[model samples]
Target: MVMQTDTVLQKMSEDDFMAVFTLGRKLGQGRFGTVFLSVEKSTGREYACKLIEKRKLVTCEDVRDLRREIQIMRHLNANPNVASIRDAYEDSKAVYIVMEFCSGGELFDGIKERGCYTEKEAAKLVRTIVAVVQGFHSLGVMHRDLKPENFLFLHHQEDSPLKIIDFGSSTFFLPGESFRDVVGSPYYVAPEVLQKHYGPEVDIWSAGVILYVLLSGVPPFWAKTEKEIYQEVLHGDLDFSSEPWPVISESAKDLMRRMLDKNPATRIATGEVLSHPWVRINGIAPDKLINS
Candidate 1:
Protein backbone atom coordinates (compact mmCIF):
# COMPACT_ATOMS: atom_id res chain seq x y z
CA MET A 1 0.00 0.00 0.00
CA VAL A 2 1.13 3.55 -0.69
CA MET A 3 1.96 5.63 2.37
CA GLN A 4 0.72 9.17 2.89
CA THR A 5 3.42 11.74 2.18
CA ASP A 6 1.88 14.56 4.21
CA THR A 7 1.39 12.49 7.36
CA VAL A 8 5.06 11.50 7.29
CA LEU A 9 6.04 14.99 8.44
CA GLN A 10 3.45 15.26 11.20
CA LYS A 11 4.83 15.40 14.72
CA MET A 12 3.83 12.49 16.91
CA SER A 13 3.80 12.04 20.68
CA GLU A 14 7.21 11.62 22.37
CA ASP A 15 6.06 8.29 23.82
CA ASP A 16 5.60 6.88 20.30
CA PHE A 17 8.75 8.29 18.69
CA MET A 18 12.58 8.08 18.63
CA ALA A 19 12.79 5.97 21.83
CA VAL A 20 11.34 3.03 19.88
CA PHE A 21 14.28 2.84 17.50
CA THR A 22 17.89 2.22 18.52
CA LEU A 23 20.35 4.00 16.25
CA GLY A 24 23.39 1.91 15.38
CA ARG A 25 26.66 2.42 13.53
CA LYS A 26 27.29 5.01 10.85
CA LEU A 27 26.39 3.60 7.46
CA GLY A 28 27.54 6.46 5.22
CA GLN A 29 27.50 10.21 4.65
CA GLY A 30 26.34 12.37 1.73
CA ARG A 31 26.63 16.07 0.92
CA PHE A 32 23.99 17.23 3.40
CA GLY A 33 23.31 14.21 5.62
CA THR A 34 24.56 11.07 7.36
CA VAL A 35 22.79 7.71 7.36
CA PHE A 36 22.85 5.52 10.47
CA LEU A 37 21.73 1.97 10.97
CA SER A 38 18.61 2.03 13.13
CA VAL A 39 16.65 -0.81 14.70
CA GLU A 40 13.17 -0.91 16.21
CA LYS A 41 13.09 -2.13 19.81
CA SER A 42 9.60 -3.64 19.60
CA THR A 43 9.78 -5.49 16.28
CA GLY A 44 13.56 -5.61 15.98
CA ARG A 45 13.26 -4.36 12.41
CA GLU A 46 16.25 -2.56 10.88
CA TYR A 47 16.24 0.70 8.92
CA ALA A 48 18.59 3.42 7.70
CA CYS A 49 17.91 6.74 9.35
CA LYS A 50 19.21 9.64 7.23
CA LEU A 51 19.88 12.67 9.40
CA ILE A 52 19.97 15.99 7.52
CA GLU A 53 20.96 19.02 9.55
CA LYS A 54 18.62 21.97 9.19
CA ARG A 55 21.55 24.31 9.62
CA LYS A 56 23.06 23.11 6.37
CA LEU A 57 19.97 24.17 4.45
CA VAL A 58 20.87 27.83 4.60
CA THR A 59 19.03 28.88 1.42
CA CYS A 60 15.65 28.44 -0.21
CA GLU A 61 17.10 26.19 -2.89
CA ASP A 62 18.73 23.91 -0.31
CA VAL A 63 15.45 23.50 1.58
CA ARG A 64 13.57 22.82 -1.66
CA ASP A 65 16.01 20.10 -2.71
CA LEU A 66 15.70 18.28 0.61
CA ARG A 67 11.91 18.46 0.52
CA ARG A 68 11.93 17.26 -3.10
CA GLU A 69 13.97 14.23 -2.15
CA ILE A 70 11.57 13.31 0.65
CA GLN A 71 8.51 13.95 -1.54
CA ILE A 72 9.81 11.75 -4.37
CA MET A 73 10.73 8.96 -1.95
CA ARG A 74 7.33 9.04 -0.31
CA HIS A 75 5.48 9.01 -3.64
CA LEU A 76 7.23 5.94 -5.02
CA ASN A 77 6.14 3.69 -2.15
CA ALA A 78 6.22 -0.15 -2.13
CA ASN A 79 8.33 -0.70 -5.24
CA PRO A 80 10.55 -3.74 -4.76
CA ASN A 81 13.42 -2.21 -6.77
CA VAL A 82 13.22 1.27 -5.17
CA ALA A 83 14.00 2.18 -1.57
CA SER A 84 10.91 3.00 0.49
CA ILE A 85 10.57 5.37 3.41
CA ARG A 86 9.24 3.76 6.59
CA ASP A 87 9.00 6.95 8.60
CA ALA A 88 10.15 10.57 8.80
CA TYR A 89 10.69 12.87 11.78
CA GLU A 90 12.01 16.39 12.23
CA ASP A 91 13.36 18.23 15.21
CA SER A 92 14.77 21.72 15.70
CA LYS A 93 18.18 20.52 14.61
CA ALA A 94 17.60 17.96 11.86
CA VAL A 95 15.23 15.96 9.70
CA TYR A 96 15.37 12.19 10.10
CA ILE A 97 14.36 10.07 7.12
CA VAL A 98 13.99 6.39 8.03
CA MET A 99 14.24 4.07 5.05
CA GLU A 100 14.72 0.39 4.24
CA PHE A 101 18.19 -0.85 5.10
CA CYS A 102 20.02 -2.44 2.19
CA SER A 103 22.62 -4.73 3.76
CA GLY A 104 24.45 -5.84 0.58
CA GLY A 105 26.00 -2.37 0.15
CA GLU A 106 26.64 -0.28 -2.97
CA LEU A 107 26.68 -1.84 -6.43
CA PHE A 108 29.91 0.11 -6.96
CA ASP A 109 31.64 -1.77 -4.13
CA GLY A 110 30.18 -5.04 -5.43
CA ILE A 111 31.68 -4.34 -8.87
CA LYS A 112 34.99 -3.10 -7.46
CA GLU A 113 35.44 -6.11 -5.16
CA ARG A 114 34.73 -8.58 -7.98
CA GLY A 115 36.76 -6.61 -10.55
CA CYS A 116 34.25 -7.44 -13.32
CA TYR A 117 31.06 -9.27 -14.22
CA THR A 118 30.01 -11.76 -16.88
CA GLU A 119 27.44 -10.83 -19.54
CA LYS A 120 24.65 -12.81 -17.89
CA GLU A 121 25.30 -11.26 -14.50
CA ALA A 122 25.59 -7.77 -15.93
CA ALA A 123 22.37 -8.30 -17.89
CA LYS A 124 20.51 -9.37 -14.75
CA LEU A 125 21.68 -6.29 -12.84
CA VAL A 126 20.83 -3.94 -15.71
CA ARG A 127 17.47 -5.59 -16.19
CA THR A 128 16.51 -4.81 -12.60
CA ILE A 129 17.62 -1.21 -13.00
CA VAL A 130 15.80 -0.75 -16.31
CA ALA A 131 12.63 -2.18 -14.85
CA VAL A 132 12.75 0.39 -12.09
CA VAL A 133 13.38 3.13 -14.64
CA GLN A 134 10.36 2.02 -16.64
CA GLY A 135 8.20 2.13 -13.53
CA PHE A 136 9.43 5.60 -12.65
CA HIS A 137 8.85 6.86 -16.18
CA SER A 138 5.27 5.70 -16.07
CA LEU A 139 4.85 7.51 -12.76
CA GLY A 140 6.32 10.74 -14.17
CA VAL A 141 9.42 10.55 -11.94
CA MET A 142 12.93 11.00 -13.27
CA HIS A 143 15.86 9.51 -11.37
CA ARG A 144 18.30 12.13 -12.65
CA ASP A 145 21.15 10.26 -11.01
CA LEU A 146 21.55 6.65 -12.16
CA LYS A 147 24.88 5.10 -11.32
CA PRO A 148 26.45 2.10 -9.57
CA GLU A 149 26.81 3.99 -6.27
CA ASN A 150 23.05 4.64 -6.16
CA PHE A 151 22.07 0.97 -6.33
CA LEU A 152 22.24 -1.53 -3.44
CA PHE A 153 21.43 -5.18 -3.00
CA LEU A 154 18.75 -6.06 -0.44
CA HIS A 155 20.81 -8.85 1.16
CA HIS A 156 24.25 -10.46 1.11
CA GLN A 157 23.10 -13.26 -1.20
CA GLU A 158 24.64 -13.61 -4.64
CA ASP A 159 21.33 -13.05 -6.41
CA SER A 160 19.81 -10.68 -3.90
CA PRO A 161 17.30 -8.07 -5.13
CA LEU A 162 18.74 -4.70 -6.21
CA LYS A 163 17.21 -1.48 -4.88
CA ILE A 164 17.80 2.07 -6.10
CA ILE A 165 18.57 4.63 -3.40
CA ASP A 166 19.33 8.37 -3.01
CA PHE A 167 16.47 10.34 -4.51
CA GLY A 168 17.96 13.76 -3.79
CA SER A 169 18.57 14.30 -7.51
CA SER A 170 15.21 12.98 -8.67
CA THR A 171 12.41 15.17 -10.04
CA PHE A 172 9.06 14.84 -11.77
CA PHE A 173 8.40 15.68 -15.44
CA LEU A 174 5.23 15.85 -17.44
CA PRO A 175 4.78 14.38 -20.90
CA GLY A 176 7.03 16.14 -23.43
CA GLU A 177 8.43 18.25 -20.61
CA SER A 178 12.15 18.48 -19.91
CA PHE A 179 14.58 19.83 -17.33
CA ARG A 180 17.44 22.25 -17.76
CA ASP A 181 19.23 21.60 -14.49
CA VAL A 182 22.81 20.45 -15.02
CA VAL A 183 22.78 17.78 -12.34
CA GLY A 184 24.28 14.25 -12.02
CA SER A 185 27.70 12.67 -11.52
CA PRO A 186 30.22 13.75 -14.16
CA TYR A 187 31.14 10.43 -15.80
CA TYR A 188 27.52 9.30 -15.99
CA VAL A 189 26.05 12.64 -17.03
CA ALA A 190 24.51 12.72 -20.52
CA PRO A 191 25.45 15.18 -23.27
CA GLU A 192 22.04 16.81 -23.20
CA VAL A 193 22.40 17.37 -19.46
CA LEU A 194 25.59 19.31 -20.08
CA GLN A 195 23.75 21.32 -22.74
CA LYS A 196 21.22 22.32 -20.08
CA HIS A 197 18.20 20.57 -21.67
CA TYR A 198 17.25 16.94 -21.10
CA GLY A 199 14.53 14.42 -20.42
CA PRO A 200 14.45 10.95 -18.84
CA GLU A 201 16.85 9.69 -21.50
CA VAL A 202 19.69 11.03 -19.33
CA ASP A 203 19.07 8.01 -17.14
CA ILE A 204 19.54 5.68 -20.11
CA TRP A 205 22.93 7.28 -20.74
CA SER A 206 23.98 6.74 -17.13
CA ALA A 207 22.77 3.14 -17.18
CA GLY A 208 24.83 2.51 -20.30
CA VAL A 209 27.91 3.76 -18.47
CA ILE A 210 27.17 1.33 -15.64
CA LEU A 211 26.79 -1.57 -18.08
CA TYR A 212 30.06 -0.63 -19.77
CA VAL A 213 31.84 -0.45 -16.42
CA LEU A 214 30.38 -3.79 -15.28
CA LEU A 215 31.79 -5.57 -18.31
CA SER A 216 35.07 -3.65 -18.62
CA GLY A 217 35.85 -2.61 -15.02
CA VAL A 218 36.22 1.01 -16.11
CA PRO A 219 34.21 4.01 -17.22
CA PRO A 220 33.54 4.84 -20.87
CA PHE A 221 34.58 8.44 -20.30
CA TRP A 222 37.41 9.01 -17.83
CA ALA A 223 39.96 11.75 -17.21
CA LYS A 224 41.95 13.34 -14.37
CA THR A 225 39.50 16.19 -13.82
CA GLU A 226 35.72 16.65 -13.95
CA LYS A 227 36.12 19.12 -16.85
CA GLU A 228 38.09 16.60 -18.89
CA ILE A 229 35.55 13.86 -18.14
CA TYR A 230 32.66 16.06 -19.25
CA GLN A 231 34.57 16.96 -22.42
CA GLU A 232 35.07 13.25 -23.21
CA VAL A 233 31.37 12.61 -22.62
CA LEU A 234 30.51 15.46 -25.01
CA HIS A 235 32.91 14.03 -27.59
CA GLY A 236 31.17 10.64 -27.14
CA ASP A 237 34.27 8.48 -27.45
CA LEU A 238 33.57 4.78 -26.74
CA ASP A 239 36.27 2.10 -26.63
CA PHE A 240 35.66 -1.62 -27.03
CA SER A 241 39.11 -2.85 -28.11
CA SER A 242 40.25 -3.41 -24.52
CA GLU A 243 41.09 -6.75 -22.91
CA PRO A 244 37.48 -7.71 -22.04
CA TRP A 245 35.93 -6.46 -25.29
CA PRO A 246 37.04 -9.61 -27.16
CA VAL A 247 34.86 -11.72 -24.87
CA ILE A 248 31.72 -9.54 -24.79
CA SER A 249 29.06 -10.25 -27.42
CA GLU A 250 28.17 -7.76 -30.18
CA SER A 251 24.55 -7.68 -28.97
CA ALA A 252 25.70 -6.23 -25.64
CA LYS A 253 27.82 -3.62 -27.36
CA ASP A 254 24.94 -2.70 -29.63
CA LEU A 255 22.71 -1.97 -26.64
CA MET A 256 25.40 0.19 -25.07
CA ARG A 257 25.73 2.20 -28.27
CA ARG A 258 21.99 2.80 -28.42
CA MET A 259 21.88 3.73 -24.75
CA LEU A 260 24.80 6.13 -24.97
CA ASP A 261 23.80 7.81 -28.20
CA LYS A 262 24.88 11.46 -28.29
CA ASN A 263 21.41 12.60 -29.23
CA PRO A 264 18.75 11.96 -26.60
CA ALA A 265 16.11 12.11 -29.34
CA THR A 266 17.37 8.79 -30.72
CA ARG A 267 18.42 7.03 -27.54
CA ILE A 268 16.82 3.70 -26.68
CA ALA A 269 13.86 3.91 -24.34
CA THR A 270 13.78 2.01 -21.06
CA GLY A 271 11.13 -0.40 -22.40
CA GLU A 272 13.30 -1.16 -25.42
CA VAL A 273 16.28 -1.79 -23.15
CA LEU A 274 14.37 -4.47 -21.21
CA SER A 275 13.53 -6.33 -24.44
CA HIS A 276 17.03 -6.12 -25.95
CA PRO A 277 18.55 -9.52 -26.63
CA TRP A 278 21.57 -8.78 -24.48
CA VAL A 279 19.38 -7.93 -21.50
CA ARG A 280 16.91 -10.80 -22.07
CA ILE A 281 19.49 -13.60 -22.26
CA ASN A 282 19.46 -15.95 -19.27
CA GLY A 283 21.99 -18.73 -19.04
CA ILE A 284 23.11 -21.34 -16.53
CA ALA A 285 26.87 -21.74 -16.35
CA PRO A 286 27.65 -24.35 -13.76
CA ASP A 287 31.33 -23.44 -13.73
CA LYS A 288 30.73 -19.71 -13.37
CA LEU A 289 31.72 -18.40 -9.95
CA ILE A 290 29.02 -16.44 -8.13
CA ASN A 291 30.46 -13.10 -7.03
CA SER A 292 28.34 -11.13 -4.60
Candidate 2:
Protein backbone atom coordinates (compact mmCIF):
# COMPACT_ATOMS: atom_id res chain seq x y z
CA MET A 1 0.00 0.00 0.00
CA VAL A 2 1.10 3.58 -0.70
CA MET A 3 2.11 5.26 2.56
CA GLN A 4 0.72 8.68 3.56
CA THR A 5 3.26 11.39 2.63
CA ASP A 6 2.04 14.79 3.91
CA THR A 7 4.73 14.64 6.58
CA VAL A 8 8.13 14.64 4.92
CA LEU A 9 10.19 11.61 5.89
CA GLN A 10 13.56 12.08 7.50
CA LYS A 11 16.14 10.00 5.62
CA MET A 12 16.75 8.11 8.90
CA SER A 13 13.16 6.83 8.76
CA GLU A 14 14.13 4.09 6.36
CA ASP A 15 10.57 2.73 6.52
CA ASP A 16 9.28 5.87 4.74
CA PHE A 17 11.30 4.94 1.66
CA MET A 18 10.04 1.35 2.05
CA ALA A 19 12.17 -1.83 1.96
CA VAL A 20 11.62 -2.06 -1.79
CA PHE A 21 14.69 0.14 -2.10
CA THR A 22 17.59 0.26 0.40
CA LEU A 23 17.52 3.97 1.21
CA GLY A 24 20.86 5.06 2.64
CA ARG A 25 22.17 8.46 3.71
CA LYS A 26 21.06 11.78 2.28
CA LEU A 27 23.34 12.61 -0.62
CA GLY A 28 21.95 16.08 -1.34
CA GLN A 29 18.90 18.30 -0.89
CA GLY A 30 17.72 21.65 -2.26
CA ARG A 31 14.73 24.01 -2.63
CA PHE A 32 13.12 21.73 -5.21
CA GLY A 33 14.22 18.33 -3.86
CA THR A 34 16.35 15.91 -1.85
CA VAL A 35 18.40 12.94 -3.07
CA PHE A 36 18.82 9.82 -0.96
CA LEU A 37 21.45 7.10 -1.29
CA SER A 38 19.60 3.84 -2.02
CA VAL A 39 20.09 0.29 -3.34
CA GLU A 40 17.71 -1.53 -5.72
CA LYS A 41 15.90 -4.51 -4.15
CA SER A 42 16.23 -6.73 -7.22
CA THR A 43 19.92 -6.17 -8.04
CA GLY A 44 21.28 -5.33 -4.57
CA ARG A 45 23.14 -2.53 -6.33
CA GLU A 46 23.53 0.96 -4.88
CA TYR A 47 21.91 3.95 -6.60
CA ALA A 48 21.13 7.62 -6.01
CA CYS A 49 17.44 8.45 -5.60
CA LYS A 50 16.68 12.07 -6.50
CA LEU A 51 13.44 13.20 -4.87
CA ILE A 52 11.88 16.36 -6.30
CA GLU A 53 8.95 17.71 -4.28
CA LYS A 54 5.60 17.95 -6.09
CA ARG A 55 4.30 20.71 -3.83
CA LYS A 56 7.18 22.86 -5.05
CA LEU A 57 5.91 22.85 -8.63
CA VAL A 58 4.62 26.43 -8.86
CA THR A 59 4.58 26.59 -12.64
CA CYS A 60 3.24 24.38 -15.42
CA GLU A 61 6.60 24.77 -17.14
CA ASP A 62 8.27 23.24 -14.11
CA VAL A 63 6.10 20.15 -14.40
CA ARG A 64 6.75 20.02 -18.15
CA ASP A 65 10.46 20.32 -17.49
CA LEU A 66 10.37 17.66 -14.77
CA ARG A 67 8.78 15.30 -17.27
CA ARG A 68 11.33 16.39 -19.86
CA GLU A 69 14.19 15.49 -17.55
CA ILE A 70 12.84 11.95 -17.32
CA GLN A 71 12.26 11.76 -21.07
CA ILE A 72 15.76 13.06 -21.73
CA MET A 73 17.27 10.50 -19.38
CA ARG A 74 15.40 7.71 -21.13
CA HIS A 75 16.55 8.99 -24.50
CA LEU A 76 20.18 9.07 -23.34
CA ASN A 77 20.41 5.62 -21.74
CA ALA A 78 23.97 4.58 -22.66
CA ASN A 79 25.54 7.94 -23.43
CA PRO A 80 28.95 8.18 -21.79
CA ASN A 81 28.49 11.60 -20.14
CA VAL A 82 24.96 11.06 -18.82
CA ALA A 83 23.77 9.57 -15.52
CA SER A 84 21.62 6.49 -16.05
CA ILE A 85 18.17 6.32 -14.42
CA ARG A 86 17.38 2.79 -13.30
CA ASP A 87 13.79 3.54 -12.27
CA ALA A 88 11.33 6.39 -11.77
CA TYR A 89 8.03 6.85 -9.88
CA GLU A 90 5.92 9.68 -8.54
CA ASP A 91 3.86 9.88 -5.35
CA SER A 92 1.92 12.70 -3.69
CA LYS A 93 5.04 14.07 -2.02
CA ALA A 94 7.65 13.81 -4.79
CA VAL A 95 9.00 12.43 -8.02
CA TYR A 96 11.65 9.79 -7.30
CA ILE A 97 14.39 9.04 -9.82
CA VAL A 98 16.76 6.14 -9.08
CA MET A 99 20.17 6.45 -10.69
CA GLU A 100 23.60 4.75 -10.57
CA PHE A 101 25.15 5.42 -7.16
CA CYS A 102 28.39 7.40 -7.26
CA SER A 103 30.12 7.21 -3.86
CA GLY A 104 33.00 9.49 -4.80
CA GLY A 105 30.54 12.43 -4.76
CA GLU A 106 30.75 15.58 -6.80
CA LEU A 107 33.95 16.61 -8.59
CA PHE A 108 33.67 19.90 -6.71
CA ASP A 109 33.97 17.92 -3.47
CA GLY A 110 37.12 16.22 -4.73
CA ILE A 111 38.59 19.54 -5.81
CA LYS A 112 37.77 21.03 -2.42
CA GLU A 113 39.34 18.03 -0.64
CA ARG A 114 42.49 18.10 -2.77
CA GLY A 115 43.47 21.60 -3.87
CA CYS A 116 43.49 21.28 -7.69
CA TYR A 117 44.73 19.32 -10.68
CA THR A 118 48.00 19.54 -12.59
CA GLU A 119 47.80 20.79 -16.20
CA LYS A 120 48.31 17.26 -17.57
CA GLU A 121 45.78 15.84 -15.14
CA ALA A 122 43.38 18.68 -15.86
CA ALA A 123 43.77 18.12 -19.60
CA LYS A 124 43.01 14.40 -19.28
CA LEU A 125 39.95 15.15 -17.17
CA VAL A 126 38.73 17.74 -19.68
CA ARG A 127 39.29 15.30 -22.57
CA THR A 128 37.19 12.63 -20.91
CA ILE A 129 34.51 15.28 -20.26
CA VAL A 130 34.52 16.41 -23.89
CA ALA A 131 34.09 12.82 -25.08
CA VAL A 132 31.04 12.57 -22.84
CA VAL A 133 29.56 15.79 -24.19
CA GLN A 134 30.19 14.57 -27.71
CA GLY A 135 28.04 11.58 -26.87
CA PHE A 136 25.32 13.92 -25.52
CA HIS A 137 25.37 15.98 -28.70
CA SER A 138 24.74 12.80 -30.65
CA LEU A 139 21.70 12.07 -28.48
CA GLY A 140 20.11 15.54 -29.00
CA VAL A 141 20.14 16.34 -25.27
CA MET A 142 21.67 19.50 -23.85
CA HIS A 143 22.98 19.44 -20.30
CA ARG A 144 22.81 23.19 -19.90
CA ASP A 145 24.17 22.90 -16.37
CA LEU A 146 27.73 21.50 -16.53
CA LYS A 147 29.46 22.85 -13.46
CA PRO A 148 31.81 20.94 -11.12
CA GLU A 149 28.90 19.96 -8.87
CA ASN A 150 27.22 18.15 -11.74
CA PHE A 151 30.34 16.07 -12.42
CA LEU A 152 30.81 13.15 -10.01
CA PHE A 153 33.20 10.23 -9.67
CA LEU A 154 31.78 6.68 -9.52
CA HIS A 155 33.56 5.73 -6.27
CA HIS A 156 36.75 6.14 -4.21
CA GLN A 157 39.61 4.84 -6.29
CA GLU A 158 43.12 5.91 -7.26
CA ASP A 159 41.46 6.70 -10.60
CA SER A 160 37.67 6.84 -10.55
CA PRO A 161 35.60 7.66 -13.66
CA LEU A 162 33.55 10.87 -13.62
CA LYS A 163 29.77 10.67 -14.06
CA ILE A 164 27.74 13.67 -15.23
CA ILE A 165 24.61 13.90 -13.05
CA ASP A 166 21.63 16.22 -12.53
CA PHE A 167 19.51 16.40 -15.64
CA GLY A 168 16.80 18.65 -14.17
CA SER A 169 18.27 21.54 -16.16
CA SER A 170 18.60 19.56 -19.39
CA THR A 171 16.79 20.57 -22.62
CA PHE A 172 16.11 18.53 -25.69
CA PHE A 173 16.07 19.81 -29.29
CA LEU A 174 14.65 18.39 -32.47
CA PRO A 175 16.51 18.84 -35.75
CA GLY A 176 16.94 22.49 -36.77
CA GLU A 177 15.27 23.80 -33.62
CA SER A 178 16.79 26.41 -31.28
CA PHE A 179 16.27 26.17 -27.53
CA ARG A 180 15.18 29.46 -25.95
CA ASP A 181 15.26 28.43 -22.31
CA VAL A 182 17.59 30.40 -20.01
CA VAL A 183 19.08 27.61 -17.96
CA GLY A 184 22.43 26.62 -16.34
CA SER A 185 24.83 27.66 -13.60
CA PRO A 186 25.45 31.40 -13.96
CA TYR A 187 29.22 31.19 -13.54
CA TYR A 188 29.61 28.57 -16.27
CA VAL A 189 26.70 29.70 -18.47
CA ALA A 190 27.59 30.97 -21.96
CA PRO A 191 26.95 34.52 -23.06
CA GLU A 192 24.54 33.30 -25.74
CA VAL A 193 22.62 31.29 -23.18
CA LEU A 194 22.21 34.33 -20.94
CA GLN A 195 21.01 36.23 -23.99
CA LYS A 196 18.66 33.33 -24.89
CA HIS A 197 20.19 32.48 -28.31
CA TYR A 198 22.16 29.37 -27.39
CA GLY A 199 22.20 25.85 -28.80
CA PRO A 200 24.27 22.76 -27.97
CA GLU A 201 27.41 24.89 -28.17
CA VAL A 202 26.46 26.18 -24.74
CA ASP A 203 27.34 22.75 -23.33
CA ILE A 204 30.86 23.09 -24.73
CA TRP A 205 31.08 26.55 -23.19
CA SER A 206 30.15 25.12 -19.80
CA ALA A 207 32.74 22.35 -20.31
CA GLY A 208 35.37 25.04 -20.90
CA VAL A 209 34.33 26.64 -17.66
CA ILE A 210 34.76 23.22 -15.98
CA LEU A 211 38.26 22.99 -17.46
CA TYR A 212 39.10 26.46 -16.23
CA VAL A 213 37.87 25.69 -12.72
CA LEU A 214 39.57 22.25 -12.59
CA LEU A 215 42.96 23.75 -13.44
CA SER A 216 42.77 27.17 -11.78
CA GLY A 217 41.08 26.18 -8.50
CA VAL A 218 38.84 29.25 -8.82
CA PRO A 219 36.14 30.42 -11.17
CA PRO A 220 36.91 33.07 -13.80
CA PHE A 221 34.58 35.48 -12.11
CA TRP A 222 34.29 36.29 -8.41
CA ALA A 223 31.20 38.47 -8.66
CA LYS A 224 28.61 38.56 -5.89
CA THR A 225 25.54 39.09 -8.03
CA GLU A 226 23.87 37.53 -11.11
CA LYS A 227 24.29 40.53 -13.44
CA GLU A 228 27.99 40.88 -12.64
CA ILE A 229 28.57 37.21 -13.46
CA TYR A 230 26.95 37.55 -16.90
CA GLN A 231 29.10 40.61 -17.58
CA GLU A 232 32.30 38.75 -16.67
CA VAL A 233 31.36 35.70 -18.78
CA LEU A 234 30.43 37.88 -21.75
CA HIS A 235 33.75 39.73 -21.58
CA GLY A 236 35.80 36.55 -20.96
CA ASP A 237 37.54 37.62 -17.74
CA LEU A 238 39.71 34.50 -17.36
CA ASP A 239 43.28 34.77 -16.07
CA PHE A 240 45.42 32.27 -14.12
CA SER A 241 47.33 34.23 -11.47
CA SER A 242 47.03 31.86 -8.51
CA GLU A 243 50.40 30.65 -7.10
CA PRO A 244 50.15 26.88 -7.63
CA TRP A 245 48.89 27.09 -11.21
CA PRO A 246 51.18 25.38 -13.76
CA VAL A 247 51.36 28.36 -16.16
CA ILE A 248 48.67 26.97 -18.46
CA SER A 249 49.73 26.79 -22.12
CA GLU A 250 48.48 29.18 -24.80
CA SER A 251 47.04 26.18 -26.66
CA ALA A 252 44.81 25.36 -23.74
CA LYS A 253 43.88 29.00 -23.38
CA ASP A 254 43.17 29.14 -27.10
CA LEU A 255 40.81 26.22 -26.79
CA MET A 256 39.11 27.84 -23.82
CA ARG A 257 38.73 31.15 -25.62
CA ARG A 258 37.14 29.38 -28.55
CA MET A 259 34.81 27.27 -26.42
CA LEU A 260 33.74 30.23 -24.29
CA ASP A 261 33.25 32.45 -27.32
CA LYS A 262 30.38 34.89 -26.77
CA ASN A 263 29.03 34.09 -30.20
CA PRO A 264 27.36 30.70 -30.15
CA ALA A 265 27.96 30.11 -33.87
CA THR A 266 31.64 30.82 -33.40
CA ARG A 267 32.09 28.32 -30.54
CA ILE A 268 34.56 25.48 -31.14
CA ALA A 269 33.20 22.18 -32.45
CA THR A 270 32.79 19.46 -29.82
CA GLY A 271 34.16 16.68 -32.03
CA GLU A 272 37.24 18.74 -32.89
CA VAL A 273 37.83 19.71 -29.26
CA LEU A 274 39.03 16.17 -28.46
CA SER A 275 41.95 16.71 -30.85
CA HIS A 276 42.99 20.01 -29.29
CA PRO A 277 46.69 19.95 -28.42
CA TRP A 278 45.89 19.97 -24.72
CA VAL A 279 43.61 16.94 -25.07
CA ARG A 280 45.66 14.80 -27.49
CA ILE A 281 48.16 13.44 -24.97
CA ASN A 282 48.52 9.81 -23.85
CA GLY A 283 49.84 7.90 -20.76
CA ILE A 284 47.50 9.23 -18.07
CA ALA A 285 44.80 6.69 -17.15
CA PRO A 286 41.67 7.31 -19.22
CA ASP A 287 38.46 7.81 -17.21
CA LYS A 288 35.07 6.87 -18.64
CA LEU A 289 32.56 9.71 -18.72
CA ILE A 290 29.63 7.49 -17.69
CA ASN A 291 29.76 4.50 -15.30
CA SER A 292 26.99 2.36 -16.90
Q: Write down the lDDT of every candidate, Cα atoms only.
A: 0.83, 0.74
lDDT of 2 by residue, 139-184 (tens): 8877888888888888778588888888888887765677777888
**Where is model 2 more than 4 Å wrong at Cα?**
1-19, 41-43, 111-116, 240-246, 283-292
RMSD in order of candidates: 4.6, 6.3
Number of the predicted model whose lDDT against the real structure is largest:
1
RMSD of candidate 2 to true structure, Å? 6.3
Which numbered prediction scores highest in TM-score against the true structure? 1
What lDDT is reached at residue 56 by model 1? 78
lDDT of model 1, residue 65: 80
